[model samples]
Target: MNLLRPFSLLLAGLSLAASVSASAAERIPVVASFSILGDIVANVGGERIAVTTLVGPDEDAHVFQPAPDDIKAVSRAKLVVVNGLGFEGWMERLAQSANYRGAIVTASAGIKARERADDDHDEHGHEGHDHHHGKDDPHAWQDPQNVIVYARNVAAALARLDPAGADAYRKNGEAYVAKVQALDSWAAQQFAQIPEAKRRVITSHDAFEYFGARYKVRFLAAQGVSTDSEPSAREMAGLIRQIKAEKIKALFFENMANPKLLQQIAREAGVTAGGKLYADALSKAGGPAPDYLSLMRYNVGQLLEKIRLN
Candidate 1:
């Protein structure tokens, strides 16, 4: 070959090597919108992906202010998973700001929603409102039945990203869904022991619409689904009035909200502040409720025991 041709081939080889080096140096960074989503991604992604959470455990994502490091994580992530139900309003802003090009997987898509309480009894505009009041509740996984859908959604998304681990992700999802079904059966069995009249519960936030709807329990709350939205004074007053009228036995606090509100509500309503609950996020690795399975068991089991005692 000619000398110039040999030199040109050498330069091309060097350029290719540099590109491969840069690409190989990058890890498959994954970002989750919040702690619960992060936990789900971790289960499905396993060790193949490096996962980061914009909002950590017990943080209200509705009001979360993501940090610089959090932004960096998202910017570098190859995939971003979110529980979309207008839950993470800031996600779009952050993703755009970071200029991330990752695939977005919304775990809540295709889930059957519960009607919002606001629309439940609003005679003012009752005719044609959808599940926002009639059918669309964002907290589907609270019902283990809905978590099966979440698992399938998560598995499909992860498989699309990394086809190599598709088998593992699928198996993990199925196994997890089976566990969720078991938990659902267990929760129903535990709650069944309670008298129908005593199935009423009071929580700090309205996070249990799905749980209540699925298990046929009544979850009266002092606040709405998100702690970020402050309850109107009239709303709070009305809740307190209803609690007293109903003789609601227990008043549990969400791990995410300001406990002061629930504490005040409990004191005003003349009910002892009840057990701690994991509504918004999984408890840290070794606290009261650890993983998803343990977390659900602890929450439902505690409620069962307390409702009986009260």
Candidate 2:
């Protein structure tokens, strides 16, 4: 009960508090190239990481131009997440300019990319890039199986950055994988309801080839892999002719693509524009698709409803 004993105890407590504060301040800062990957990082990283999404929800990353703030964000981050496979045409330049020395994790690391099979190719076509560094299709996230790879990459990256949060990230990654599995199962059941031949639909761009390959839905578009590429008159007319010949049930626009192009196509093709699809980007919060799971569900549901044979 000496007064000196109490003073010494209080000093030790203060030192411990300071140590805890310093550790907490070291929280890893992460920058994701786009919204979909941002959500994936958030789900896996949880509270241990601070995430900044360069391209926001319902925004197109195909034609995204990084601002000064984006460079600053990348420069300050300990981890920068990109879809890689040449998805972000501007990301390499931006990262180099910012001198981002931290770990640049390619979320689509292990997935095998699908090659573009279209004969009429445009400049933005996904021809040369593969899963990690090739010009293969960059829309791998459209298939949920590939997203499992993405979640694992994110968890492993977070673990590497902050070992203390490794267990938490692993648990989150496992849970997200389960959710994706369930979603994939649900999608299969829904697709089974429709006849295979009637699964074709037209959208604004060629962003859904991976989705089509996985889900058995055939997506036709006037533009190539990159939405920034312009639709040629011959391509549009050819798509319209194909739509008329196939009697394609529905035409749709993506959240990122201009609806006017699809509207004109629909008019010429004698089809109505279906509900907007979440292709390159997700819908805003409180909208049809606010997260990865919701985005897949919404797209699948819309396809089932619109493309079903009457």
Candidate 3:
């Protein structure tokens, strides 16, 4: 109750407040282009980073238009991460507009990109209509091997941003990479169980080209790389014919894609729709595909179950 005791207590409170402020300031602020990449950053950055995802879970980044709030996120970020192979078309403009002077990391860097032609299929009479991503496909994260690259790049970028946390970032990245490796092996075994003839699938769009390439499955799609574009009538007719001719077993649509086109193709082709895939985005927290590991495992399990049922 003495005046001197109260003055000392006030000084102590101010010191505690300053310490808390410093601790909060130490955390690296990161901005990720989408949910899938944000999950990767969280794993690699761990508690050392606070991530802001421009396009969040169950959201489509392919046609994502940046809002004004995104600029504020970018302006404060110490690091900006994106899937570089032409995936986030709005990212560059957003960063430029925000005057973000931070390090931009391409999570897909160093992976051997699959060419757009690799996923291109005939659209019957629609000669000009094709699923294209310039020269390279941007869905490399579909393959776990490519995600290993993403983890490494993220770790390196975080190390640069927060040198004191380099060891922790690298350790976390290695642990996550181990999980991805295990998933890749498990996927291979699952795919091997299915005969080559039974590996063909029809999806809502060309989002699974990298998945098909890695797993040795063939994916036929009605729409192009970007879900924003509607498939032409002739294009849908051609895909329907192909599915019927090939006796395709499984037809799946992405979580963010409109199911109507895939459903139409399935109905016309006389095959039941397969399970929904988490292609462009992750599922919500506590959901089946909350992270990269769960997403891959969930997708493979769905494909295996659906394809085998046919």
Candidate 4:
């Protein structure tokens, strides 16, 4: 009787494992261009979809190169979501290479995109910087309000692909949007505590234009809209001068960008370098900014803490 009991228990465990595997295999497959967008889609899709993120956490998407595995993932996906606004310049080529003919959803479709300004010219009036993206700055996710739009777009896309899960997607998306709205309100209140004049910040790149516009903060960066370009010597010198003259003490480094240039500028300007900010990507799992909501809160806390020193 004891031997028979052990055999039955082993058979039951194997049956449960097989059932779980089949349930997971039945989920809809979706691919997101990067981690931040992936997290948003995951929240919207919930258990109905399986998401594959190409550019991972703490990785730079500005210079991301698609691998063979990425092509395979895209080819197998039912829907592909991208940030749009020319953010993922490599997406089209990757899709072509993968022979993907599925629905490609633009997460930033309905939001008002910020245009790229030619604010990098030196005193000589020469074009001192180069931009890799289109006329719009593609970092709309920086603002939680914009992410509300993103969540809706993703939910709509998922519903079209899986009509049976429409109500579920809608409910999930609305819940996520409410959280985002709350984050935005909290952020606005936090920023209001500091005087407008003390809301200036410096970073390695111009990835926070949307955040700056949303919160009424001024963000000055060493590079242009894209992080691929290097600032000219004259341009760098001008920024250092402004940092010193303005006594901007809230200098920060981006998580995905090389910190060498910003560190050099900080040393030359005699200002201490502040903590890292999650600009283009989220932190790895178990880190400070693992998901979208956590990313916004962590960044707001860091900014407020350092800007107070200004």
Query: Highest lDDT: which candidate?
Result: 4
lDDT of 3 by residue, 94-173 (tens): 99999999889999989999876432565333343443357777999999999999999999988987899999999999
For candidate 1, the per-residue lDDT at 220 reads 74
Give a tens-digit lDDT track for model 1, residues 79-152: 89888776777888898889988888888888867767664322212222222222345676687787677778
Query: Which RMSD does model 4 reach against the true structure?
Result: 1.8
The residue-by-residue lDDT of candidate 4 on 1-310, one tens digit each, is 4879989999999999999999899999999999999999999999999999999999989999999999999999999999999999999999999999999999999889888756543431225455668789999999898999999999999999999999999999999999999999999999998999999999898898899999988888888888898887777888889889899999999999999999999999999999999999999989999999999999999999999988
- Pairs that collide in candidate 1 are 113-135, 113-137, 114-137, 131-135, 131-136
Report each candidate's C-alpha RMSD, comma-separated, in the order given: 8.3, 5.2, 3.2, 1.8
Candidate number achieving the greatest TM-score relative to the actual structure: 4
lDDT, candidate 4, residue 110?
A: 83
Off by over 4 Å in 3: 1-22, 118-120, 123-132
Model 4 bad stretches (over 4 Å): 1-9, 120-128
RMSD of 2: 5.2
Q: How are the candidates ranked when ordered by TM-score, highest leading?
A: 4, 3, 2, 1
lDDT of each: 0.76, 0.84, 0.85, 0.92
